[model samples]
Target chain A: MSGLLAVESAGALTTVQDRGRAGLAHLGVPRAGPLDRPAATLANRLVGNDPAAALLEVTWGGLALTSDTGVWIAVTGAPTPVEVAGAGRGSGRAEWLPAGGRLRLGTPVTGVRSYVAVAGGIDVEPVLGSRSTDTLAWVGPPRVQDGALLPVGAPHAPPAPLDTPRPPRPGALRVVPGPRADWFADGALDRLCAASYVVGEESNRVGLRLDGDPPERVRAEELPSEGMVLGAVQVPPGGQPVVLLADHPPTGGYPVLAVVHQDDLWQCAQLRPGDPVGFARLRGA
Target chain B: MDVLDLRAFGPAAVLAEVADSAAARSLAAYARAARVDAEEVVPGARTVLFDGVRDVDGLARRLADWTPDGGPERGPLVEVPVVYDGADLHDVAARWGTDVDGVVARHGEIEFVSAFCGFAPGFAYLAGLPEEHAVPRLDTPRGRVPAGSVGLAGSWCGVYPTASPGGWRLLGRTELTLWDPARYDPALLAPGTRVRFVPV
Candidate 1:
């Protein structure tokens, strides 16, 4: 049976997200999806939802919701406080909430974003084949707001067993040498890997802006706009590297020094402001 | 049919530099038609980026002998009606060494093709303008240019798909929705589509 949930108090930034819209970059559409794919997938699996099913991606939690019908749900990513109907309930495991029962998620003790997956998933209407709210282009459904009513699709898959928490690995993010590495001065890649960078406060879904020694460039002229891929580490005029994320622009004019490995992108998503980050080069695939 | 260079963008994608924008567009069109294993066949100023490449070696071989198919000829003619009332209308006319009416006449006479879409969703970079008509961008961009605001920069013309900061030289405004997520086709001006600006 279909279910409905009402948002009581939306968090600092909450939006519906799924696997994201693809094959539309040529049309200038950003690939808007869950920043943490593994966490989102785990949350969906715990609740017996499709891996690509839409869910609530809460940033810095404060989300409170009550379903009209009993539903199965799970919260994953950035271990946070989760309570069901006033009782403390742990996250990362499927839990049943009786009809009229509320689910509240408190601020994360550490991480930056969290995922909440319902059995049937967030059934908001899909745009461009995804329900993900693109914070940059303002594409897809509107952001979840206080008192907003969310539709839940009928459950499909069976719930899976709770697996061990897979926290983001610590240490340096891995990188592959660039499509535009020549634009930088000699030893630029070495310099980038040698120095530690702090996550800038201005970072968002578009990119993770960094505060560190700006990589010096040999090319001073403006580079004509070129296609940018996810994980592209583009160095703007300021010299600081900005790692392109899920909602980054499809094309950019700045030269890319390197690209972070896709597997390590989750760490970039979870990095909080002021967190230190280092890059490690991965050669010859 | 000559390929200038092929450089690895990352582990998966490659940027193939070609002769010109037309060649880049042709390559992108051919790749999409041939169902290349790449996820995105994106055309830029003078290069095409084949992203999410599944068979890098296979693609490399295909690109080695890639011949330019006359250029993209998909999609229908999209007429954009403009009011010719923009913040930089006079500035654009001044740069063109022409009066407001002359500028409108010159802009309306050309048939522009959607060379690429970037900067913002649904913002297609329309090409076909002669080199003599090239215009410069604003020294300082406006914080927000409303959606449907038509503008020109360098040798390209485009309409802002959504309200955002831009530095293009404004020429007019169109009422048509350049992008609509609710529609079956979100982007009104997909690449290769023919576009005409009508002065209303």
Candidate 2:
């Protein structure tokens, strides 16, 4: 189905996102894709949308929308209450929303981000080959606003059969020692793995700022700005480590102590402020 | 030919350490020109980061086999007109041990290279200032630096592409549009572009 999805309420923060703009970091452009990759991928699969098709990355839920045509929709990540025409519908599976049906979402129960996928993806104009919004650089399509009419693309294949969602893995996040690990004090890596850090309130798409014992530094000289990467555990002079995310700056001056394993990075997207987290050294990294 | 010290950045990338910023720029330029099998070839102050390489070991071996001989290709020259009335112009003059006019003349004479882009979109780290003329950053960063404000920190010069907090010592303001998303190439100063500051 292809039509328009009118936004009734855009919630706290909502933006159109897809696979994101890669190969542009050299120009200082951030790769602004969905923070929770697996969730977004699942949402698209459930609705039969192309893997790279754009979707809504709804933060803290509360998004309300109405469609002009019947369409298959699916919600994934941080299980939240979904309603269509004032009737309750289950998340993590495709559900048909009739024409003129009002669809609404409640606050998520656990995670901080939620993904909403329509049979046809959100067809916003792509910048640098993606529809994802880079909050840091203000690149790509504008943020989804209330009363905005978002065009939906033509649907492809039929929705996938409903499957049980995989349970979240439990344990400390795995990390590999960064190149600048020598900039920190002796045993700094051990200290970093030992301490439990709480997510700071200042956290956003750019990074997850942690509040805990700052890793001690041995070097006093300032580090010249260097290229940064996704999941870099950069520690500022203040000592708190900020785990770089999808929208992090292309370069930074802080010393990176470790890089979180790519597979474990999605967990950071769902972590709420004040949530306790810990890290462990990845063996044979 | 100097060898690069390659270090593991993460699972998908490798950090190649170079001798200095000049070598870093050269390495990045060579990698791009050679069409290195990587998603991004990024240049920093003293490192070139190759990210999204499927086979890190193979890429490292290939990189080791090559040498960064010639410097980056001299890109098209872009002349930027400036109004030399920045907030820190006097401070910079005092530090350079010259009058305001002398500072302007010295800055205008050098042809700077766009070393790399960082800090903000379209903001290029122009390298040309001699080591003796290096300037220190402001003790405290300004809350908002106007767009098109040309500033110097240490041995590098840059134009603020957008209004944001910054600590670089302002030398002047340029009327040129540094960044525009609608343009075919958003950044006015891509890496390797040669630039000259002309006093208008």
Candidate 3:
């Protein structure tokens, strides 16, 4: 029988996400997945499974639950402290959750999201080639409703827990010149890396609306909506930078200034409403 | 067919725009080439995306040595039956200087092609709406357009394979499921797949 866990309380923005939906954007399905990839990867490693295993993506970090059977569980990402029966389960690391043990994820300390991984994986019907919860599309096969039993997979093989996680060094995110890089009159790329940009409140899983000092736009002409990619830095008429993210539409009309590197995308995912950020140009291929 | 203004967009994507009809066909032509096996291409109402493998030199050569599909017969012409009654029926009818019944007859007569599939999963940019039936998008698009709700947005018309937020004026509904993950062919409409409307 699969390990089952009952959902007690799911935090705001909690959604089931895996590696991501691939090869489907052309049909208009945006890739919906975890904001923090390495964290999600770490969580899966703690449970002895593939890094792409389905995990519960909890944003603003407040998830609580109880396992219905004996199973392994690990919590990763952010500084959301975990506990079993009021005893600390550790934060920024992974731990085992015995059967009938209570697991609680407190508020996030610095990051915007965290992921909880079970021994197997979150067993859910794959919709449109993904287990990612696309709230915008309502293709969510199921949500973390209280008392709803979450189905797990085969038991994990006996193994030692992962080594203590070291925090990532915060640095400026790197980006490649976007498809519409030349739309700007001249030295727009220079100013993009020169100035620090802040994350805006209007941002979500769809895309990040960057604030801070604005990037100047040389042109002010109407643009037809064209294909948009994740990490694409599109400057609207107002010159405010919009960094596309997971769940981004297939197309947009704005001129793309730059594209954030896939490896550095986690920085954009961890940004809060007022977090300041800087861009670094990724040279060459 | 009238050729529209072609503009260079992303180093990866291009836009061949037209005010209406004659250009929709030519735009569809480039869309066919852009959407080959090796290259990742996405077609829109008027623009097409040619992304990945950033060999601008190779792309120019490929286009220079290109061959058209001859005609729409390369792909099967799929007929979609839909009810010609939507929330925007009256509004669309008036724009065409006709009643609701007249709009249905004209709409069903033309052949529409899969110009592109974007906006949502399996949602296609279908061209071939009659000139008179064409109208601009709504001032404010509806937050949720139900799946299978056939509608016309400007000179283009298409079915909502997946429910999403859109501004197209609806004319009816259909039973064909365009997107299904489990199915061998998820999207019923593929580029080059021909489309014809039938009033159900």
Candidate 4:
């Protein structure tokens, strides 16, 4: 099944994404990928597509699309209200979209972004070897807009076999101490783990800004600009922590108190504004 | 050549603090030449961060034994034609106790090597200026500096790849695209590439 998917309405921010463009940080290009990796992978798998195939990343839902031909699709990430031609439907499973069928998604009840995957994936022109869009740097194809037509790739593999439900997302993210942890007053990491932080409204793919007690700094001297890694819990002069994400700058000058483990980054992606966040310290460097 | 210092950046990255920007660039060059298999090797002012390494121990051993081969090779020169009509052109000239033409001449005389890229994609931190030539950033950053606006901050001169909020003192503007994803070389000023600013 292959044809065009017409974008009726793209709510908030919607962009095509894949596994991301890697090894380009030296050029200061960020690795822009889906926030929820497992969700994206599962969506692709359910539709019998390559795990890294580009898919529609719908932020705050409200995405409506109509296919020109029959197609298989699966919606993953924060469970949300879904409908096919005004008929209520469920996600986490593949469903056939008949020709001219309209698929609509409502705002997620708990999460921020949702993934929509078709059998052959979103066949958009790639930039820097990845279809993912870097919102921070304005790289790759422009963000999805209303009335845009998305060409569907040619389907190759059979539909993925049905599998058990995925594990629930955890509230406490695991993290390890950062190299600049010493720059902060002792027990800063402990305070960060013990206290709860609410996600700031300014949060986006670039980073999740946290609003809570500011960690006091022991040294007032400035740290030279250095390479930043994904999931780095960097503390700016304001003392609040900002967890770097997919669109974070390749380098920064702030002191990083800790870095969340890669496995726990999905939780960060699903986090909604005003949602509480807690950290669990991990042993070993 | 000494092993300098190697420290863990995060679980997935290791940062090597070299003696200077030259050493930092050389270390990044060595990593590229040796095929270290890291996802990204980012060189900074005086540090090189190796991210997404599968074999940390093996990489550490190789870096410890590695020596820069008489400094990294200077890649092809990228000439940037600039119109010296920046907002701070007169201010920078006054700070240096020189006239507008003198400031432009001094800036155009030196050949800068791209030491690192940061802040924004293709925004290379070109290093070559002497201490006296270095100038502080603007007291307040502009909301949106136009793309290709050449600027100087501290000891580094860079051209903004895209329109963005910046604190650097604007010195001029260029027509050349600093970053183009569709091009074979996306970043016009990749690290180690020599740069010469031509006044038009």
**TM-score of every candidate:** 0.96, 0.97, 0.85, 0.97
Candidate 3 lDDT over residue span A134-232, tens digit each? 755555456677666888877556433856554686788887676566678576777888898888899888888987666666666766566666678
Q: Taking the tens digit of each residue's C-alpha lDDT, what string does model 4 give over B1-200?
A: 35568878776799888888888889998899888969999998988999999888888988987775575356789999999999999999998899999999999998999999998889999999887889999889999999999999988999999899999998899999999888999999999999999999
Q: Write the per-residue lDDT of candidate 3 for residues B1-200, one digit (tens) a residue.
A: 33334443334444444543223434455645465432445555555555543665555445544433344444568999898779998998898989999888888888887766767777777876756667888899999988999988867888988777889999999988888867776778865577988998
**Candidate 1 lDDT by residue in tens digits, A211-277:** 9999999989998888999999999998889999999999999999999998888887789999999
Model 2: CA > 4 A from native:
B70-73
Query: What tens-digit string does per-residue lDDT give for candidate 2 at B78-156?
Result: 9999999999999999999999999999999999988888988889999989999999999999999999999999999
lDDT of each: 0.89, 0.90, 0.73, 0.90
Ranking by lDDT: 2, 4, 1, 3
Q: Could you give candidate 2's per-residue lDDT for residues A122-222 as a string of tens digits?
A: 99889878899999988999999999999999997898847666677756889999989999999999999999999999999999999999999999788
What does candidate 4's lDDT look like per residue over A195-225, in tens digits? 8989999999999999999988998988877
Q: Judged by lDDT, which candidate is best?
A: 2
The candidate 4 chain B region of ten consecutive residues with least summed lDDT is B65-74
User: Which residue ranges in model 4 land beyond 4 Å of their true spot?
Assistant: B68-73
Q: Which stretches of candidate 3 lie over 4 Å from their true place?
A: A156-160, A164-167, A212-222, B1-41, B45-70, B130-133, B162-164
DockQ of model 3 vs. true complex: 0.40
For residue B110, model 2's alpha carbon misses the true position, in angstroms, by: 0.9
Across all candidates, what is each one's fraction of true contacts kept? 0.78, 0.70, 0.47, 0.81
* Candidate 2, pairs of clashing residues: none
